[model samples]
Target: MAKNKLEISYEIDFELVAINASVKEYKLAWMLNKSLAWNLVKRENIELDFTGNKALLISNYLYETEYQTFRLIRNRAVDGEEQFNAFIIPELKNFDYFIMLENESVGFDLNAFISKIKEIPFVQFAVLMDAAALKSKDNLIF
Candidate 1:
């Protein structure tokens, strides 16, 4: 039988290195990219809440799930915190996804985000990201 693919999404804000690393080092951004890809290979449609990377808030269909995979890509860094409301609002405009992460950002109003995310018509799952997965899935993802 064919393996069914699930759509997985995450909110990887500032802790790219720590979030992505089994053992964290320098080059947090780079480590995050590597770690994210490594973690999501089992899925098909992957939406990344890049509000952590400062890339931009945009969605694209990635045919190549191996080397290039992303649906919603936005970065919280470099993008300025002021624009956070705009960025996050748009992510919820079209899709309902679980906001995945190890923990919440310090300055961020996590409670506000949670309330807003849940209110979004498209957001079906707003959660602590990988909090549950790590406890049950693997030792490395935590």
Candidate 2:
């Protein structure tokens, strides 16, 4: 039996209340990337944030199996972009599924999302899956 590889991305925009409320795009991207690190093996939640102000990414395969590995590196913006290029590079030789979700409380277009995302050469499969629903599926087995 072969395992399925899935990668989900999400971003929550909270009203930053600070004297300056300064947030670099890299930090926000790193935070969302942190959300994707789900490990059933370690039974642990590790949030690894990058150390930079620019849009930088570190693609790490924390959970790997013979069939597949979940690789996700994200940089979030109002739109599906960043000044610096953020890539989700899979470092394995296997047929896999890639799921990308961008749920902003503001601007997002379904047609545009699918068209551009599917066009990416490296992406074998890509689409938006609801974050809440995915969380439920992660817990329940049928």
Candidate 3:
């Protein structure tokens, strides 16, 4: 008797973007998850993670006044003292926020998806980490 083995493969990629720390992670995630732009590329096959890093050397380049202004506006919004929309201005020099995207579908157009992501406000930089094709699957020797 002989048994048949099956293998499944996917093209996984990571998209890195620097977002403003003042922008809530959930809000950005929600925007990405709900946007038609993201959905067109197969919504169920992607995963997103947001992280913050205060130690990056780039942080040193930001002026003290900019950081203070950001905090002030963010605090006011959080405290319900202001009804203004929090705009993510990368020029303020805050790029501590990081967004990592894991794409699990082989047919997904990464370049197109990334371009759309960059359109979101406050995205200082958008880059594709390890552009090489990566395949994830179990090895089977016959």
lDDT of 1 by residue, 25-119 (tens): 12322333344443322222223344365333322122133333222222221233433433323323332222233343346565664554344
Query: For model 1, what is the error of residue 39's alpha carbon versus the real structure, in angstroms, after optimal superposition?
Result: 20
**Would you give me the overall lDDT of model 3?**
0.34
lDDT of 3 by residue, 67-129 (tens): 121101111112123223221222323443444444334665658766776776755555553
Model 2 collision count: 0
lDDT of candidates 1 onward, in order: 0.31, 0.32, 0.34
lDDT of 1: 0.31
- Roughly what TM-score does model 3 have, to 2 decimal places? 0.35
| TM-score per model over all chains | 0.26, 0.27, 0.35
Error at 58, model 3, angstroms: 20
Residue 87 lDDT in candidate 1: 32
On TM-score, the stronger of 1 and 2 is: 2
Clashes of each: 14, 0, 0
Give the CA lDDT, 0 to 100, for residue 51 in model 3. 38
Model 1 spans > 4 angstroms off: 1-97, 102-104, 129-134, 137-142
